[model samples]
Target: MARAGLTLERLTLEGAELVDEVGTDQACVRRFGVKVASLYLHVKNSQELKTGTAPLALEELADRAADALAGWAGKDALTAFADA
Candidate 1:
C-alpha cells in the first residue's frame, strides 16, 4: 500500500523542492524519501514529475505577482510585479 498521507500533490511539491535543492536532473523519489515503485504510481517517471512541478511553480509565481501588484499601478505596479 502507498504510505500514509502520500499523494501525487505531495510528491510534486517535494519534487519541486528537490529541483531547488539538487537540480531537475536529481529530482526523484529517493531524493525526497519514497520508493521508486510508489512514485511510479503517481508519475510515469522523473521527467513527468518535473513537468507537473512546472505548473505548481507557475501558479505560485502568479499568486505572488498578483499580490504584489494589488493596489498599485503604473511604475509601482511594474516594480512590484517584477520583484515578485
Candidate 2:
C-alpha cells in the first residue's frame, strides 16, 4: 500500500536515494516493493521509474547546493555546489 502521505514527487526522491544506496542497475520497483506490479501504480515501469529519479535527483541536488551557497558567490558557490 502507498504510504499515508506519499506522493509521486516524494516517491521519486526516495527512489533516487535508493539508487545511490544501491546501484542504478539494481534499483528497481521491486527494491521498494514486494512485487513489480505494486509499483505500476506509482511508476509506469522500471525504465520510467529510473527516468523519474534522474530529474528528481538533479533538482534536489541543485536545491541543496543553492541553499548551501546562500549569501555566497563565485568560489564559495563553486565549493558549495561541488560539496553538494
The 10 consecutive residues of candidate 1 with the worst lDDT sum are: 24-33
Model 1: per-residue Cα lDDT over 2-65, one tens digit each: 5777677777888888777887635566765766777787667777777779998899899999
lDDT of 2 at 12: 73
Model 1 TM-score on a 0 to 1 scale: 0.68
Q: What's each prediction's clash count?
A: 0, 0
TM-score versus the correct structure, for each prediction: 0.68, 0.59
For residues 1-84, write the lDDT of model 2, one tens digit per residue.
753554666667777888888776245455555355655666666677678788877887889988998888899888877887
Off by over 4 Å in 2: 1-14, 25-44
Which candidate tops lDDT? 1
